[model samples]
Target: MRAYADFVVEYKLTVEFPNFQDKIYVRDGEELARWWIAQTNRPDTIFCANDEAAAGFITEIRRAKFSVLGDIAIIGFDNTEVANLLDFTTIHYPVDQQAENAFLILQNMLHSTDKTLIPLEYTLIERHTT
Candidate 1:
């Protein structure tokens, strides 16, 4: 999560919009709302660390009279059930593939003594929340 945030900063997303950092971090939706209320310039796009936070953010923003996806575009990691229910855009973690890889590594270890690296894949599911 920190790496992604660093990437956003390294690529100049934060430089382009300084408010990105503040709007992206909060204890919960209520705190997010408080931050939004205090912001002179509210960010239209937010990238949450997880779907739970994204869902909370969406609920709070709507409560504050902002349209979800229309007024704010939110992206979250971990494409959980809540994210699907809310039709939010999120990064899908391939847990099955990861488990398979781990199993294979154990099998290999039992048969032979060798070190191998396995790569995991992730997908971005685009939905109404963008």
Candidate 2:
């Protein structure tokens, strides 16, 4: 949240969200959409925690007569299959690479005493949604 706030401040962009403890889920999207609808100055875009939330949010947004990447844009993390099906923009987490690196790290640790950090890569998949 601090990073998002910092980005918003740096770019002078407005943001809004409901005060929810757990913001993960396909169901939480409806809750977020309801919050957006209630706002007088509704946001033009939303950054969801994951594809499931984005999917859920879009479901409600469409039900409320809003269009994805038209009336509003959406971006999510994890690059899930749901994101592909929805054609939503998302940040793809390198899960496979991370797991492979972890396995190698553990194997090396068995012989070496030194602990080191492994770097992995991530990418943005720009789809229909921004």
Candidate 3:
């Protein structure tokens, strides 16, 4: 949310954060699809917190006779197996790198007390869903 807020501020874009007051999961995303269709002016794109939610959103939209990346676009995070299977755009989270960093941190901890924190980074894996 903070990252999105920063992006909106930096670009001076008017974006609305609708309070669905529910966890951002597959069910929520499905519900969101219904809400989206009810809107007179629908958003051009949606940024889901995870691929599962995005997949659910895609399924629901397609069921409603809406075309992917045609009626709306979607971007999801945590490029999971579903993301690849669904061919949706997502952020490739560096799980392997994070595990390696953890190991290095532990090895260093045994020798010294210096605590180090690696920066969080992600790669955008573009796919047709975007």
Top-TM-score candidate index: 2
Model 1 lDDT tens row, 1-130: 5786799878877433333343333356546655765687887787887877788788888778988777779888888898899898999988787888888788888988565646777899999987
TM-score of 3: 0.75
lDDT of 3 by residue, 2-85 (tens): 777799999999866586544468887788888887888898898887888888888889999999899999988899998899
Q: Give the true-structure RMSD of model 3.
A: 3.4
Worst 10 residues of 3 by lDDT: 15-24
Listed per model in order, the count of residue pairs whose N, CA or C atoms clash below 3 Å is: 0, 0, 0
Q: Tell me how far candidate 1 lies from the true structure as C-alpha RMSD in angstroms.
A: 4.8
Stretches of candidate 2 exceeding 4 Å from the true structure: 7-17, 100-112
Question: For model 2, which pairs clash?
Answer: none
Estimate TM-scores for all models: 0.67, 0.78, 0.75
Ranking by lDDT: 2, 3, 1
Global lDDT of model 1: 0.75
